[model samples]
Target chain A: MTLQILLNLVIGMVWMLLHDEWNMLTFTIGYLIGMIFIFALRRFFPGRFYGIKIWSIIKLLLLFNIELVKSSLVVIGQITRPKLNIQPGIFKLETKLKSDWEIIMLTNMLALTPGSAVLEIAPKEGIMYIHAMDVAEFKQSIVRTKDLFEEAIIEVMR
Target chain B: MNVSAIIEIIVAVMVLAGTVLSLLSSLGFIRLPDIYTRSHAATKSVTLGILFILLGTFIYFWFMHGLISIRLLLGILFVFLTAPVAGHLVIRSAYRSGVKLSDTSVKDELRDDLKKMKQLEQYHSKEG
Candidate 1:
């Protein structure tokens, strides 16, 4: 645990330095303070330090970027065209994911994707109500989207 | 513009775009009629906006320092993990609290399930 704290501090400093936004002293101080908060709450949390599954998270980041790029183009195209061709609707998706962390990950991913938003999630029933700007396309694609992203979350967190 | 100046401009543009998107999403939060609609704005728009900001940061760091540190990656990771969870909690709470939808809302399967459950409860009570 102490080692993890030290590692986090070191990593934080490197991050601050790389960004070239904050001075070294400020970064170090902030890093120390942040680590203290993490250390203090370490035992209260479960699953890898801070409850993050690292490799799975990396995969998610990659997937998110890909989706973002794809959605950006789609959205930009829609904006440029004359007609505002959107079929907006809210749909309920049944998710098999159980943990709070997993559900959160899934919704965030959904929200980030172009033309979709996670309106509400009922964790007790594993249901998520999502609004899609292009509901017709989403309906056709949702199963694949959930299978890809939500399944990854289930594997990582559960 | 010099290479550094151009990079800075690009980063600034990205940041500004992200900020605008975030604000728009917040507006959606307020303007959207129902809890479900509001949540949609809050979650999706915010996530995309944040991603843009992070991407800008990542690019700025890569250009300025010549190396991609794990820390920025971690920040991205943290946002990705927490944003959805927060959305989920809000939605779940809304559902449990009995927030109703607009009349135009079609095909409420969850409501149907709840109705079936109530009927089952009544039947069991009569038998008992």
Candidate 2:
């Protein structure tokens, strides 16, 4: 990814120098031209263009932030209530993610969202032990959230 | 209030909210039943709190001083990346060392699986 970005930057610079224009507009036009060229010769590249991956990454981050806000509110509500009546427990979840990077990302995202924290992983078993603050209430929601997150993570990692 | 004042107020509000959330996370440490739940409080609430605080600071600098601070942006990103991992590590070690769950815990679905895995490991070792 970094290599692709550097190549694009170099192309943009070369285009600007050729036109003798040292301006943002010149650089942008050069960048777009380089992007098209890269797209045309994409089969020669080892991986997808850096731009597409970056967009997916941004989408994942956005989904993460949205979950963060939503779960934070839920936690705050639980905290401020007059009674502490949460039933926390550890539950087993089967993870569809195969790669270490994807699993790491999913676990971190899960931990940051309220109610669920990854307690342990059985890598060979493809399972995770997740502790949820209110297990009964959160079981279904957690599964839903995990599916959403898994889909987003796969979109980004693939 | 003028536009600049309004922006300042927004920044102040965000910072205040973040501070409150951080305090709530600390309160969770006191009120929560055990290590697992406390870790959840620490990871989620505190992370969101710091994110909010840093983001407000970023916006304040960008809008009020017209200076884009890369440090604040990186701080936000690093906090997001590291906080949960740290929390996870702490809780995992605690569990491995045989910390007992609180009485209020409704179930432990992982326990049987973990035991079965241990038995399998022992059996494999015996065969080898």
Candidate 3:
């Protein structure tokens, strides 16, 4: 828990730096306020941490960026052509991940990627509905993306 | 126009265009028929729009302050990384919820394959 708070602070610092807005006093005050809010929310929700391994999260982040660049180019190409050739469709992807945080992370990752959207999550069936730009090849992509994300996520959460 | 003024103007135009595109995309999301179409609107429009806005910010910071440029780059990198994954998950959830396509859908290969497989199973059971 202490480590998580430290990590959040580091992330916030990085964010502040990127935006070129930094004040030491503001950072400290905001950090404490954020910590308080987090703890208070956690108490109300009463959920367990999935025990994320830092290395696994790093791996996921790396994989996510690589895919993001590739997908962004693909989307750009599709949009720039004289004739649009999008075959959009929804696909159900099964997951072995049982934790809410893991699922949320997976969903967020999908949403961040280009040409894909997470429409719904059915926890009862452990299934995620994803929209792919190229629905014709959705089965393959769905399996590939879900497997890649779920494996890394489950490993981290373990 | 001076170089700085020209750059500023360009950035301003880009930001305006991006905002307009983003608004149009959100409107499409609301107007679209199905989850798949809505996802298309949300993903494509917002991604491009945000990219433009960030680009404007990057240019503005680069010309005006010339500090913390790396951070702006990282911000772009983070947004570039995360937007598509969110769209994928939304589509995934919609599919798992049994969201149906519109009647005008021309081709549904997935449904066709499922139907074919069911027929095959029925035929095999009858043979047994």
- Measured by DockQ, the strongest candidate is 2
At residue A93, what lDDT does model 3 achieve?
73
**What is the two-chain DockQ of model 3?**
0.20
Q: Estimate each model's TM-score.
A: 0.57, 0.90, 0.52
Q: Regarding lDDT, does 2 or 3 come out ahead?
A: 2
Give the per-residue lDDT of model 3 (tens digit) for A16-77: 66657788766776666555555555654434331335556789888876765555555555
Of 2 and 3, the candidate ahead on TM-score is 2
Model 1 lDDT per residue over A1-158, tens place: 44665667786777687767788776876676666666677776543463255567678768877876565455444444455454556678889888777776677677666666666556888887666655676665655677789767775665
Report the lDDT tens digits of candidate 2 across residue range A72-104: 888888888889999999999998999999999
TM-score of chain A of 3: 0.64
Query: What lDDT score is found at residue A48 in candidate 1?
Result: 49
DockQ for each of the predicted structures, in order? 0.19, 0.79, 0.20
Ranked candidates (TM-score, high to low) = 2, 1, 3
Model 3 bad stretches (over 4 Å)? A1-52, B1-35, B48-52, B55-128
lDDT of 3 at A26: 61
Stretches of model 1 off by over 4 angstroms after superposition: A1-60, A69-108, A114-137, A150-158, B65-71, B115-128
| i-RMSD values for every candidate model | 4.3, 0.8, 4.9
Cand. 1 TM to true fold: 0.57
**Candidate 3 C-alpha lDDT tens digits along B1-128:** 78889988999998997787677766665555567766666666677678778888888888877755777678767776666566666655555467787543444435554466569889999999
- Alpha carbon lDDT of each predicted model: 0.68, 0.90, 0.67
